[model samples]
Target: MLTLQRRQLVGHDILLARHGNHISTMRVDRQAGRVVAYLDDGSVDSAPNLITPGLPMPATVRSVLREDWKFFAVATACTTGFAGVMVAAAVALAGLSGEPGMTQLLSAYSGT
Candidate 1:
């Protein structure tokens, strides 16, 4: 639960190190009188030694958007199209049933 600023050191005062491609929040813990980096992925490293202080953290938001925005956009478009189709189908079914509201929907579901 440490609020780490960009390029901050993973010192004794800091309890976490947010770094890497996945932006993994590594927990800084003292074990056997040594500083350790506990990753959420269940890996551990010697924090003080392995991590270099004041190293610039990568901008994950920009990286993700740049690398994966096309996929995200495609997914969003597909979802929206599917929703539109569903709504249109429902409206058409309701109109065909000659009834309004839930009654039409119920009849359609009942196949009656």
Candidate 2:
């Protein structure tokens, strides 16, 4: 007969089981809400939940970037630059508008 053991930790859960001569391990990350299973046959399976917004990357992307992480570095740099530009634009627009634009538009509409 095979037996299964389970352990619950603060931020994760682990399961261990044996079938015949093979042992399987499973881990669940509570924060990420993801599950990974390592089968006795040397196979790995993962299930990721959508606690965060954004589309999941395809398997092909992982395969292509497996050896080269410079792509990710460049991507991060581009994202940071884009965010900075957006913030600057917002600040400039706020400064340009201030209270004068609103007061002028209201006075014109009210005929005062």
Best by TM-score: 1
Task: Show pairs that collide, candidate 2.
Answer: none
Find the 10 residues in a row with the least total lDDT in model 1: 14-23
Q: Taking the tens digit of each residue's C-alpha lDDT, what string does model 1 give over 9-110?
A: 445333343334432444444353335555557775554622544654555555557878999999999999998998787776766775566545544554
What local lDDT score does residue 103 receive in model 2, on the 0 to 100 scale?
Answer: 45
Q: What is the lDDT of residue 26 in candidate 2?
A: 62
Query: lDDT for every model?
Result: 0.56, 0.55
Tell me the deviation in Å of residue 42 in model 2: 26
- Cα lDDT tens digits, model 2, 1-103, are 3233332232222223223234376677657666666778897755553433474333444455674688788999999999899767666665677687754
Candidate 2 C-alpha RMSD relative to the actual structure: 15.5
Model 2, position 105: C-alpha lDDT score: 49
**Cα deviation of 63 in candidate 1 (Å)?**
0.7
TM-score per model over all chains: 0.40, 0.32
Model 1: residues with Cα > 4 Å off, grouped in runs = 1-59, 101-112
